[model samples]
Target: MRQLIIRAMATGTVATLALGACSSGSSDGSAKGRTPYIGVILPDTTSSARWETQDHPALEAAFKAKGVKYDIQNAQGDKAQFQAIADHMLKEGVNVLMIVDLDAASGIAVLTKAKQEGVATIDYDRLTLGGHADYYVSFDNVDVGELQGQGLVQCLQGQTKPIVAEVNGSPTDNNATLFAQGYDSVLGQLYNNGTFVKGPNQSTDNWDNATAGKNFTKMLAQTPNIGGVLVANDGMAQAVIAVLKQHHLNGKVPVTGQDATVPGLQSVLDGDQCMTVFKDSVKEAQAGADLAVNLAKGQTASAANAMVADTVTGKLVQSVELTPEAIVKSNVQDVIAAGAVTKAEVCTAQFAAACAANGIK
Candidate 1:
């Protein structure tokens, strides 16, 4: 899988095909008098702000640019709603279906049904562990975790034997597991060498920020000297930061996050968060859109250059694995330049000086 992903990155074929499709101007790709349509089911809006704020618009623009008929809906974190939306889309005669599954069970059920209906299925972000999908599009999630772990290590460079607590994402999300694996691989070395003390490690339910805050609070109470935190994403990081602030340890202890949301960037600028990982949603959306367009048009969808193993089935699934970047205070402006966040959103009155200091105009 790593070799395939490296080959794809080296060749850049996925980006070329996706970009070419958008500019081709051959809108109608239907066959047998059937109107080609794509259906997209998002997992939820709660886990990260990216689903609605980034992925949705990026996907809408991509589909519109290709002149494809499509429907995009969010399950709002409800498994039943996710299934209902998939059933309705299938009933409406969609030729391709893409999803960011809430869990393997719910996603497997939806993917299985779509396959039975003869529809092409793509796993958008979260890959269903046992489910079969024609293609999968997501960032290299383990790499994302490794970056977070490295960021926390960088932040605690001089601290001797600092306790590091981990606030991981939802247990049900496969990405979370992969993320933990990545970070633990890095942090484990420090723990083994006695350079860092391991503290409480817990996963939040549904990536809930409130639950994360509660979990971190309990962990802090149990071990009050936690010098660093390895949080899974920006939302949960924000929760952990809140707990740190309650104890007046906000900027004193370093925290790592992902998604590079406005709050996360602001936190980084203000020295509250040590770092974040930025995954280009526009690029991801375009890749998925390109695949759906090909499937909808009855054309042979270009095979993604990468592959990821299905942990449950032990089969490698074709995948479009995008690279992720780590963001620190020195490079916060890069995210704004990449169009992930606006300067105005991240550089409010409270953060104005920090923005200016970081060269963010």
Candidate 2:
């Protein structure tokens, strides 16, 4: 839930993205004439829509441009299925296997198997805790959480003894852990300083929005004075907003979310959501492609690999960590202008006036 990705997370540039369109796929599903194959395993269709909606398409374009054959599939949150998919890809003799683990345990197994088969593995988006991988590709996850926490602090400007409820992402997700580290640093300080009150702080299982909504509703009931909410991603934030509306406390409470989803942005436009974090998908996909493509070319490592410290392993895995952006009413136009979203998409009939009002055109 890192609030739909802090409602983010996409990364980007026209020239960087253009690399994906540089080469076309070969007829034999190989990279040029290398007989290269790349396999990507996404955690689940439910955890984040970006897996299918953004990463898949972007990776496909990247691999196509490199003339590489690839197999990408979703695990559907099942460990068995993830193993099965990995088995198949291994049998395909893939040169690189990238995965977004559902949990560290399962991810470790998959990574271990890939290593045994002599395939280069990538820890994409979510890190496989304590697992060995060729590289990791994701955004500055802790910073993503920090943005949410900072945004929530701003939202609590007028409130007194504001009860700040935290709806974090799945505990098993590495990105979630980093996000928690970020928000906790910010909000925890506030709670200690008597600036904000700590209310219900819970992590969702599998980043389930339904569970997040229910948990948030119960928190509201127990802490009738909840003033602001820090939801890890846009999906859970949307759920929380629904519950807020039912209690007639929607816009009154400043809700911070991550993942600049369509609804998250609209919520910001309507003032129901205080802010969202934006990570460009294209940029993240580009990073993963760079690693995967290089591996397929038999290159071991590159200087572009980012140095990221893995707290659990006491080692820094070669990573490609991008930055996150804070999305608010003041700067939302940046998202539209960056081609992350379109005027046609955001300027709906109800939002058209608001879009123009916000200089979105």
lDDT of each: 0.88, 0.80
Query: What does candidate 1 score in Cα RMSD to the true structure?
Result: 2.4
Q: Give the lDDT of residue 287 in candidate 1.
A: 87
Write candidate 1's Cα lDDT for 46-119 as tens digits: 88998998899989999998887899999999999999999999999998999999999999999999999899
Query: Can you write out model 2's per-residue Cα lDDT over 132-189, one digit (the tens) per residue?
Result: 7767788878899899999998888877888889998998888888889899989989
Instruction: Identify the runs in model 1 with alpha carbons over 4 angstroms from their true place.
Output: 1-10, 16-24, 27-33
Q: How big is the RMSD of model 2?
A: 5.2
Residue runs of model 2 more than 4 Å from their true location after superposition: 1-34, 303-305
All candidates: TM-score: 0.95, 0.89
**Clashes per candidate, residues 3 or more apart or on different chains:** 1, 24
TM-score of 1: 0.95
Every model: Cα RMSD to truth: 2.4, 5.2
